[model samples]
Target: MRSLIVTEFMSLDGVIDSPGGGSYPHAGWTFKDVQMDEAAYDIKGREQQEAGAMLIGRVSYDEFAPVWPTMEEFAEYNAMPKYVVSTTLTDPQWHNTTVLRSLDEVAELKQGEGGPILVHGSATLAQGLAAAGLVDRYHLLVFPLLLGGGRRLFATEVADKQRLTLAEHATYRNGVQLAVYDVLR
Candidate 1:
């Protein structure tokens, strides 16, 4: 079975909304205030390469697909397999993408094939994945600031708690802490 890894750029308070731009109030909190160094980039690059495929929720796919494909720096990530969980999204604009219409479809994909499937910036999807008991690892990039009101990374429903072991922890120049945990149930 393919391992499911959840990755997100969250705030100190666990807010994971609109880290991309200023369309929302939570936007620009991490980038405007924080500085990313080469060492941090290298670590992120290495983690990105290790995953066989990327899985995301509809909102995150919409936010990332447009930018990453055109950005030359993220060419490797652009070409990797992408699985999007969406019920209402009729057509996915991004290339090399597949959409999951139902919970059953996601289950099938999780059990299907390939290496670890890394999920990025999809809180709802992550919650669903967690509820389904599919996630194998949790990789979080926690920023210093806290957005007082916004969507959170955690799910409202109580999930079957899985024991997690710390895999790695690193601090970036900008005070962004990277925490990687392996699910040990």
Candidate 2:
């Protein structure tokens, strides 16, 4: 089976929302002071090469679908297949998109042939996937500042405990801690 990897940008206090400039009070907090370093660029390049398809939630898909297609940096990501997890979302205008209505559909998608399924910025769906033991890895870039409050990566009590093995880690000059974890099944 292809690996399902979840990547997130978080704050010191665990806030993950509005990193890409949503309506949240602390929106765009990530870009306030941090610039992309060599290490960060390397990681992004590596993920772009390895990810065959993107598995994301409705909200994140909505956010990315509109902007990424127009950005030069996101050209490759726009070309790759996108699987949006949503019950209310349909008729995706983005090229190479498949709207999935449930986690069962997501599981079915996982069984198909591909490289790693990259999950980005879909905290709720990702948490559901984690609970279902579908997540294979987690790549979190934790920033130094705290937002006091916002949506978190794991905001609720999961029914089961999921242990992770540290796979890789690094700290950038801009105070972003890049932590990679392998989810133990």
Using lDDT as the measure, which candidate wins?
A: 2
Q: Which segments of model 1 are wrong by more than 4 Å?
A: none
Give the Å error, residue 28, model 2.
0.7
Please give the RMSD of candidate 1 to the true structure. 1.8
Give a tens-digit lDDT track for model 1, residues 11-125: 8998888876737765876677678566655656876778788888888888887788889877767888888888878778788898888667777877877777888887788
**Candidate 2 residues 82-180, lDDT tens each?**
999888986999999999988999889889898999998877988899988899999888988878888888856778988999999999888889899
Model 1: lDDT to the true structure: 0.80
Q: In candidate 1, where is summed lDDT lowest over 10 consecutive residues?
A: 35-44
